[model samples]
Target: DLKMLYSAYAMEVLSDGHLNDDKLAALNQLRNIFGLAKYEAEAIITDVKARVFQTY
Candidate 1:
């Protein structure tokens, strides 16, 4: 649920089609909330979709 909020924020930042600092931070925080060990910027989106969206 929390990650969903964060992903929404991340998506807003990504709407411009660029990964800015805010988007990266949101992704990292979302990953942490999911108990993911750690992830680079590019991989966190996939993790969120795989781990959060599917189950919801």
Candidate 2:
């Protein structure tokens, strides 16, 4: 469930070139909505960061 949520969030966040504060807030809200633990959310964010940066 969290993985699915993360994928959806990733698609949204990646639509733009950056992850701004508003996007981050939305991500946190999404994490809460999906009942993801803090660590799980952090892990998903970290992975996304890695992929985003890897493109550079």
Candidate 3:
């Protein structure tokens, strides 16, 4: 539920093809709000980044 929401948000954050510090900060805040641990968020973000790269 929350994870899925965060995952979708993560993908949107990565849609620009770059994870700048500000974007990372935003993701961090969302992760905390969604109660997802840092590692889990990192894993989901990494996965999203990988999938995004595959399309390029």
Report the lDDT tens digits of candidate 1 across residue range 1-56. 65566556565555555657876776676667766555443454665445454444
lDDT of 2 at 23: 89
TM-score for candidate 1? 0.42
**Location of the lowest summed lDDT over 10 successive residues in candidate 3:** 10-19
Q: Model 3: residues >4 Å from true position, as ranges?
A: none
Better structure of 1 and 2 per TM-score: 2
What is the Cα root-mean-square deviation between model 3 and the actual structure? 0.7
Q: Of the candidates shown, which would achieve the greatest TM-score relative to the real structure? A: 3
Per-residue error (Å), model 2, residue 6: 1.2
lDDT of 3 at 31: 91
Return the clash pairs for model 1, or none: none
Q: Root-mean-square deviation of each candidate, in angstroms?
A: 6.9, 1.8, 0.7
lDDT of 2 by residue, 1-56 (tens): 66766866776696555888888898888888888888988887888777777776
- Residue 36 of model 3, lDDT score: 92
- Clashing residue pairs in candidate 3 (N, C-alpha, C atoms within 3 angstroms): none
Q: Per-residue lDDT for 1-56 in model 3, tens only?
A: 99889989988888878989999999999998888998999899989999889877
Model 3's alpha-carbon lDDT is 0.90
- Please provide TM-scores, in order, for all candidate models, with all chains considered together: 0.42, 0.78, 0.93
